[model samples]
Target: MPDSVGKPRRYRELTGLRLGTLVDRLRESLLFLPTVMLISALVLAEFFDHLDHRKIGPVIPERFQFAPEVVTVLLSTIAGAMITAAAVVFSLLLISLHLVSRQFSPRVLRGFWRDRFSHLLIGLLLSTFAFCVVALARVDVAQEFAPPYTVLFALVLTLGSVLGIVAYLDRVIRQQYIGNIMRRVLAESLYLIAGLPYGRHSGGQVGEPVTPPEPGSLGPSLVITAPFDGWVQQISRRGLMTAVPEGTVIRLETRVGAYLTKDTPLVTLWPPPPADQQHRIGQLVARSVVTAAARSMQHDIDFGIRQLNDLALRGLSDVNDPTTAAEAVARLGSLMRPLLMADLPARSVRDESGRVLLTPNDLDHAAYVRHAFDQINVYSADHPLVRETVTETIRMLQAASAGLPGREAARAELDRHLGTSRRHPLLTQAARADHFRSGDRRPRWRSATTRTG
Candidate 1:
């Protein structure tokens, strides 16, 4: 039907395929079959060499026995095969890790050692089984064919080398290379997706009522304006007017793109109008009302910035002084919380029905407050203050939970805070509610707040 729906679906499918390709590449590299073959060959060669040196009879005399020159040739061939196998395995593992890490999370690959342990053990078992099968097969071929006593030595060397290589490759792949490559790929992909042409697709869904702009279409439609007539002043880009005009300018009370209300001025005739000029002023009185609202808003913003800067400076000054720093950090957290709360994305806190509204400013303020708390935590990781703040945040979350008429959310936030130790009271509160005693009404907590002087 609509191109809007079709385009997003197509993009998603392509993105999914790209991710799958990455995973396939990773699996091939990490689990190359050639490596296994080389490993088997190396074990076989080592077993024969050990048997010959120990004067132990071969398990397969006719097929495998050789003179000194032939033994030298065989050993060289086996060595080459083992090296080839290792190279193949390592190269594939590196490439796969690089590609998969780019498309997905590195955390997903965390348990590689544990997961691959069973496979390695199975490989060892199969190698032993194959040796036994060969021994049985060679029983009628020659009297010299018997069990190789050096099998134990060969087994150790083969398994040890494989393990060492795997460990080295795993470390190099996961730690040094994969994460950086993956991060870059993900960032670029996200940027590309965001840059794609998608027309006026509102994040808002259908059936929502859109609020239209206020009436009076053209130039300032109001008649009666501000009582104190001044020159035209600074106007916002969006047409919100501020009464901060220069003294020399004298023009109409209204400008193009300015909003008109019941109290907005109509004209500013040159020279002074006598008090007797109140004759036509009655006509101007009934039109509109536009007060100086922008000035007040600007003042509040400036004041807020100044206060934040001052608090930040104070905290910095007390950095070396633990006690003072703690107090300053706490204040900063309190101040920043409101600012962050005011800045959060409205959609994040809003309910599905969209009836519940949350202000972006509130969210933003909360985030800043959380950041301040994080700084505090970092500063006091080994100190008692961290525990104190953690406890305080829990208390705040508890209060919020109680206010909301549920302990579930508060408990979740507390648990999350315990794990992360990062500040963000609302997040902690929400996470706590979700995690702790999901349906339990009573506030159940084992840890008591340890007071810090």
Candidate 2:
């Protein structure tokens, strides 16, 4: 059940999730920033033309002034040059992105897409082209008049574009480095983790308690099926609680990351609502749920973890780069620390009155840990460098999570992977296991049961 004191926090988290998803979509799109800049450039051009036409600005010195013919030629040249430069810069960026995807994991492409610097560079270049094009239309060679300030502004943009491209290239080169890529992914993942609706627990109930009906007391159940096939992206828990009538019990048939086909069971309502209210309630429930053609990190923790794991696997592949894989593993461990210490919310959430309102099938802490590292464990089994890194990462986590509810379960999972004997002596409750040594070259054990006896 959702914590009584945590209801407000949960609402804020969901609101943040919606905002984050919207921002992410805008950031990922190629047109959003450029389009905004283009419009700004056009507006600036018109403003300058107005200033020159009304003779509002200070008079320019004769040396700085240009004939209408000269101004038109310059604007045309700048327009053509900006467009050509933009084409070249982005073309090179695409090649770099392609190589980075091939070298690392394709998932990292999202990181590149979210890069603001690259966006700004392209926006500036395109906007410069747009400004010059608009300014050219304001030139009046027949009347022997040109917008002087506007022409000067176009020149300034041309210079800025040249300098921007150089800096953008440097950024692209540095971005290809594996360390930068991992750090970028880690930062984004951490942000997503902080806003997640888990970990806060209070003793008191938040809503009024409603008594549940006895087993089989429900006359008939209402099964809500998926309207279309797609991934379960975001489910608004608060929305679900608000839409349903008091005392209604909701069972979520799918989770945030699960994919559903058309007509698949999406939700089940127990002790179904009155005949007249069923359809309206169903529509509300559907509105609260969101689906997409692809997975995203907006509310899916697993998706972010998957990106890190993919990087680790790339390191373990024919590349034979254990250092890179170890780095990825270390970050994964850091990411898992907070999740281990916090109190995960219950699958069954109750109203203020303690009546169950929402039942969601979210993955538990142990399951999340396994999902983050299971694949790396398989491939890193033979590489001691990577294997020892995993060992130390889990050891740190086990020690950090001491006395927490999730500790024992995580410890048991560690034992399953590295064997009981491999559990570092310091982190174990039992007396030191002499067979294990931190510095041992080959720490391999035949099985968890392998013993000196």
TM-score of each: 0.23, 0.83
Best by TM-score: 2
TM-score result, candidate 1: 0.23
Candidate 2 C-alpha error for residue 47, in Å: 0.5
RMSD after Cα superposition, model 1: 24.1
Model 1 lowest lDDT segment of ten? 237-246
Regions of model 1 farther than 4 Å from truth: 1-30, 33-38, 41-119, 139-453
Best by lDDT: 2
Tens digits of per-residue lDDT for model 1, 1-453: 112333344344434434543443443342443358446745775566566457775354354333334333433444454456555654655566565444333432432322354334334434443443343333332333333343333345446656755665565455334234333323322332232122111112211222322223223322324554332212111011111111111224443123344445554322223345333432322122222322111112222222323333333343433443444444433433333222112222222222211112211222333433444433343344444654565455444434332234334444444444345443334333533565664533223112321
lDDT of 2 by residue, 1-453 (tens): 223454565556556656756776898888899899999999999899888888896897676578889988888888888889989988987898799888898878877877888888889999999998888888887765577888888888888888998898898889989888888777766765665444221112234434444436755788888777888777776656656566667777877777878887878877677788877767766755678787776667777788889999999999888899999999888788876776555666677633465444677777887887677866775466777787788778778777776467776775555545454322221112422557863534333223311
